[model samples]
Target: MATLLVLGFSSGLPFYLTSKTLQAWMTTAKVDLATIGFFSLVTLPYSLKFVWAPLMDRYTPPFLGRRRGWVLITQVLLLLVIAAMSLHDPRTGLKMLAVNAIAIAFFSASQDISLDAYRTDVLETREMGAGAAVFVMGYRIAMITTGALAFFLADRTSWNNVYLLIALLMIIGIAATFVAAEPVLNDAPPKSLAEAVVLPFADFFQRAGVLRALVVLLFIVAYKYSDSLAGSMTTPFLLQAGFSQSEVGAVFLGVGVIATIAGVVVAGAAIGKIGINRSLWIFVVFQGLSNLTYYGLSLSGKNHGFMVSAVITENFGLGLVTGAMTAYLMSMCNKRFTATQFALLSSLMAASRDILVAPAGKIIEGVGWPGFFLITVAMAIPPLILLPFIAPWSSDVPIGAAPHTGETIPARRPQPPLAVRR
Candidate 1:
């Protein structure tokens, strides 16, 4: 779990550095909103990450194990791009920064593919839920430190120092990868690359309904819509609320961070006590309700305390909601196609946020805060409506039965002898 936590940062740090944190960098640089908005497009690689997931599945990196190789490779590239990103001015080198952002997102997405695969493979069946919980706790911390602290640091120090700190911090992942043991596979390895590449696609398509896949995609996209769309406007909103920068950091990044960790911890415990189904429904509804915090803050005339209260509540709900959600998604993937299907589901899930949420600035500009938030609440509806349909569709487990979620389930052959390298 400690190793997973470190690796989680490798996956999560690039996310903030490229998205919200980058926006903060640009706004300071006097870049225009339209141009800054264009930077969001750099996240395209995140939504389209499934494109290269197959390559990761087919080819192992020469140095690290298959999973760790991709992670190491991406980590190296990430440090380079973030460092390069630090060197350029978004105003004069906006185009160059855009290029760097894409590179980071690409590397970040690849890192996700390998790390998630390892997390899934390493833990036992029933333990998967717990693993997801721990991993997300780590991911959320990375978001806070990278997303919130990076902004806080950039405010006080040079963006150069902030980026440099984050780059070197990635060494945690490198070291973790080296020390960590490889995971046991539940299924037989493909004898050839074609079987490796071809099976996942066939497995995905051969499942029950065409509309089901499409709807699953819709759920993936919509479930996160409210959160992501509302997020784009948070900094501006906090500024408008008359809070000082320190207050914003201390509130959302500080207390909000603590609350989020608490929520994740509680959520994991809840998932263990209650089954994933009950946990899912409860958390999903809680997720939609959490958005009301923003509405409350907005309607309360942006009171600083109100903003703090709202952030804490929303993040807590998110920690609870997301921990269970990932476990559910894990239960839904076929072990045979774990990398590809998961990448597909996860990328689709991110698309809901990155693609759907990009319009937040426009919406807030057009509709005002109250209206924009209400629209965000409306965006939450599709996923809740869609979850029931998806909750029943198991790519890994059958419809009526719960997943083989508990136990190691006894492997026929113990995980391929670590002594032999393919």
Candidate 2:
């Protein structure tokens, strides 16, 4: 858990530096909003990371074993690249700044591929929920450090110095890598790049059968749709509803952070007793229903108490849903193809947030804030309907039983059979 926490922080630190923090630097340097907006393209590697995931699965690094080796290499590259950004002035070095930012994104995305696979490979089935919670907690904390804390530092010192300090922080990840134990996989990595590329897809489709595989993918996309949709518009809703920026930021930093962490920890423990399937049913409902808090706020105008309640309820519910969903995704991965398969699954999950939510503005234009939130609540229903088919209320173990547990190289992991018996 401690290892995952540090790795999660490692994964998140570079993310904001290249994107949000970089933009802040440019804005201060008198760069136009248009260029800053275009800079968002630097983050493309994250969405497309699955394309190269098979290579990591096929090739093992020379030191620190398979996953750890890749983790260390990426961490080193990230530290160097982020530190280098300090030497470039955004005004004159705009092109070079873009290049360095892209480098950071690539290394960061690659690190996530390895780090996620390592986490999936090492964790016991029973530990999945708690493991995901701590990892997310670490990831969120790192975001705060880069986002809020970086700006705070920039106010006191130069942005260049802030980058230098953040770069030094990567040593935390490097130290963790040295001490972290590598996963003991019973199967050898795929022998060829071709095999690595072909087999992960073939294995998944074969294991779940074509129909069930499609449904599982659909479930992955739909499960978090409402949350993504509502979240994309949340800040705007709060601002439009008459709350001040400082008020919203304070609530998010105080009540929002505390509630989210509390929710994740509570859900992690609950999943152990109630199982992932049951936790999903409960948490997903809370996640969806929490949108009504915004609906209530829209009607009430800017009541401080209502805003606090809304932030707490929404953030806490999001934490619970995120924990359960991550465990469920981990449960679906085959150990041998952990990197490729997890990348594919998580990318599709990202698509739900990035792509599917693009239409939110148009939808809200038609529906208004109160109606928009109500629609978000309604969007959560389809995934719940899918639960009976994909997860089933009575099953304690995951759909494919406990994935990555007690398996030998030659033993074929059991998969959900082709037919769903009603």
Per lDDT, the best of the predicted structures is: 2
For every model shown, the clashing-pair count is 3, 0
Kindly report which residue pairs in candidate 1 clash with one another. Answer: 125-405, 126-405, 126-406
Task: Tell me each candidate's TM-score.
Answer: 0.78, 0.94
Residue 57 displacement (Å), model 1: 1.1
Per-candidate Cα lDDT values, in order, are 0.73, 0.87
How well does model 2 score by local distance difference test? 0.87
Report the lDDT tens digits of candidate 1 across residue range 376-405.
777667777776776642233323222343
Candidate 2 residue lDDT tens string, 271-378:
878888999899989999999998999988989999999989999998998999888888888878889999999988898899999989998889888999999999
